[model samples]
Target: MFTQRSRCLLLIFLLYFVNKISSKVEFTNIKCNTFDPDFASFEYCFLKSVNRTYKYLSIKVNLHKTPITKVKVNIAIFKRYNGYKPFLYNITKDACKFLLLKNPDPVSNYIYNGFKSFTNMNHTCPFEVSPQKLPIGYINQQVTDVLPVPHGDYLFHSNWMAYDIKRATVNVYFTIS
Candidate 1:
């Protein structure tokens, strides 16, 4: 036995809970471009789908120069509206310094944690690029832990820089449903 206002409030709460529980994040596409081929080159960069429900992103970069002492990464997120417009997140971080942190910033930590398990860039300064292609991906894993955002298409754009020079850019497209 509930009043009208109480029933309406309960229904709203249930709807919110259901929406939160059913939300999922999936990678739709990825694009990579190198600004300086002499410094670095993309070996492979693409989104891979294993099945209808499973997909992953894979990327590899071959660095011509060795012992990269300084590295920085810029990340920006965009949501599709009339076109693509900037969303909530835009971050810039020194890669080496961030790797050394015991407890990093929340935003950077969230982004790093998402791909840390699949990346070889876990160590601090003086990175020696190996001859082999370094693959970074979340194989067979669906991204569940993510920022709470409305269901929409998103673009995660990142710039990889080394030695104060922009080396490459990666654009990852995803959808939340």
Candidate 2:
């Protein structure tokens, strides 16, 4: 029989591998870039594309709450040709990450944005799965909201710390098509 510590270690190892295998990488639309002057103060904003084939925006959550209750998310999108046309998509929290509140209220006073790559290099392209080192700009966000990315571009905003979660990393994987 395995010892308690051994079992715990095994569980942790399994969870780590499971998280990696399950994580999906989604490419961001570089053209639809926006700067959220309100939230992070000139922070870069990206509208990521999502679909059934390319679903799952993997985000890591660091939590201080013994058991997290729910996560809140804000979402926005951009029109392809409208020049910052405001669009929105509904995100469903994936069970792979954590459960979300049944009734999630939208957040104001914050604009969502992040890093996106239009080119894919064998070394570094997908922001989350790339083996190459990430530059100063490509950083992960805290507790994020979820939704099936629409056929267009979208922006997301959330505070992981709201649920007592902090210091987390998020990775989004794309399906090879």
Best by lDDT: 1
lDDT of 1 by residue, 34-90 (tens): 999999998888766676765667787888887788999899989999988999889
The superposed Cα distance between candidate 2 and the true structure at residue 21, in angstroms, equals: 31
Over 4 Å off in model 2, which ranges? 1-26, 29-57, 80-83, 90-153, 156-177
TM-score, one value per model? 0.80, 0.25
> CA lDDT of each candidate?
0.75, 0.31
Tens-digit per-residue lDDT, 1-177, candidate 2: 999999999999986765543222334523221132221121232333354443222222222232323333334434343544544543433221322234323432112213224222112111121122222123322112232232333333322222333322222222211
Where is the poorest 10-residue window by lDDT in model 1? Answer: 131-140
Model 2 — TM-score against the truth? 0.25
Candidate 2 residue 6 C-alpha distance from true site, Å: 71
RMSD of 1: 4.9
Candidate 1 structure, TM-score to reference: 0.80
lDDT of 1 at 16: 83
